[model samples]
Target: MTIQTVAKQLTRTTKYRLNNGHHIPVAGFGVYLLPPAETFDLVYEALLQGYRHIDSAVIYGNQKEAAQAIAQFVKDHENVSREDIWFTTKIWNVDHGYDETKKAVEKIALEVKESIEYVDLILVHSPLTNKEKRLGTWKALSEFNHNPNNGVLQVRSIGVSNYGKKHIEEILAIDGPVVVPAINQLELHPWLPRTELREYLTKKGIVIEAYSPLTQGRHLNDPELLELEHKYKIPKAEILLKWSYLQGFVVLAKTSKKERIKLNFEVLPEGQGTNDPLQEGSNLGKIDLDPNILDALDKPDSHLVFTWGGADPTEYED
Candidate 1:
């Protein structure tokens, strides 16, 4: 499809149907480096601003705060319920073996049971372990996904993170009928698009969740991004987010500021509400970049790649 076609199709509230038949919001709020003391209030504010998806992980150290925030938001809202929120958490690298993974997941389910019903999705945080342990971890997650009555861990879908072609192929090559991963959360931005892997995942029907889609605001001052910001009068991060959504990837935006959380989720700046007269005849009239600009932002040269957190586990040998 053409860039314009993709742009026209994308909206602030688009949802992608996962391979497991569950739908995930295209825009998600992530709390990666958020301070433990401030996670609750920020996450609650994100829910109040219409973010239905909350992405957290064991490594992030704020999963409990996030769960409580979701639970509280549902209780305080009129029609919202546990089902209205999509809560996702990941198993850390330390918990990569079959037994270890099971224990970690069970611990998560146990810890958050009082707050939320069940985790919407659980992903192996990274493919940092050897093949044996990686496949073993996937096996455990697959079991939990297939057997709902497996005690407390009622995960709707299971997936992987930071997995590359070889890592995914290892799971696909299993001898028996293995449950294919529903999603692959990855570090994606204009600079590191992983073109080949993205096409591979698309063909396999695995949804790609764009984690760090904004480059963690590290390179928001790129000349090209600045150009778009000036031309569109929107924040550089929004432009990067639009580029990510336009590519049919689920976007996870992390922010601690209440206003930026809303802006990131809204994809529509404060004064540019949908009812604004300027957006009358436009499709998703929030912040539509020209096709040429989108083309330029489609993954830059190798030297320009910006891997947030100073590490790219997808390329890990293990």
Candidate 2:
């Protein structure tokens, strides 16, 4: 199936309702590889520039700074509160077992509790651990969901990252009532579409969150993307983001620049009459891509096109 077949009419205020009834912003600002020292400032810039979602992780080593920025953003904006923004973090791979997961979560909760009241979502960072450990991690997160008061940290929802169909099936096959994951974030981009897995995820009602949507600026120069860049009169990065959004996937874009952050969030309709991509507008629109163009970009085996940092954990089996 074509990626944009299930595309929703999106606006700057558009959010996808999860299975748990929680709403996640269509666009999120990712904080991967951001320096701890500069994370607060950059994250604050993103929030100020109209990014309502901030995606961070325990392994990123800057969750504290990201939390501080969110806290400060809330305090400074009179109309905005904690609930106005979405904050997502993850448990590291080492914290996969039941006991270790509980302790790790409690520790992260304690660390960020002073900055923010609760996290919007917490994900199992990867599926590289053994099946037992993976289920244990989910169990720990499930318990936290069922009983938020059990610890200092409170998470509104739980999910998995880099999980394939088999991995998700394990979670679903758990012995008793389990909180089905609300999200399954993956290293998705034009090069690595993962179409089959996406179809399975859609059937199961799990939202696909696209990370590294731009291929970390590595494939922006592709002939087709560049042609589209010229045709749409926008950067290839925005073109890729629109592609992900059109596919009904929550897209996370990371950049340290303020203008780029604004560009990534404030996508305008065709006749907005503003050549300046940084100009703010409420009506968000999609980049018009023909079906053939979308098909051309769907290279399933291109997962090896680039390595952001680590291997694709979705391929890992233990």
CA RMSD of all predictions: 4.7, 5.2
Overall lDDT per candidate, in order of appearance:
0.80, 0.80
The worst-scoring run of ten residues by lDDT in candidate 2 lies at: 271-280
Residue-wise C-alpha lDDT for candidate 1, range 57-130, written one tens digit per residue:
99888899999999999989979988878999999989998999999998898767779978999999889889
For residue 232, what is the lDDT in candidate 2? 58
After TM-score superposition, what is the CA distance of residue 120 in candidate 1 from its true location, in Å? 0.8
TM-score leader = 1
Give lDDT tens digits, candidate 2, residues 1-318. 233333324656567778888888877999999999999999999998777889999999999999999999999999998887999999998999999998988888776889998989999998987999999999989888877787557888999999988899999998878799999999888788888888888778788898988888778778887777776576777678777776777889999877788888865233221111111233344455544455555666766536536476787778
**Stretches of model 2 off by over 4 angstroms after superposition:** 1-8, 268-296, 308-310
Return the clash pairs for model 2, or none. Answer: none
Candidate 2 Cα lDDT to native: 0.80
Per-residue lDDT of 156 in model 2: 89
Task: Return the lDDT, model 2, position 190.
Answer: 77
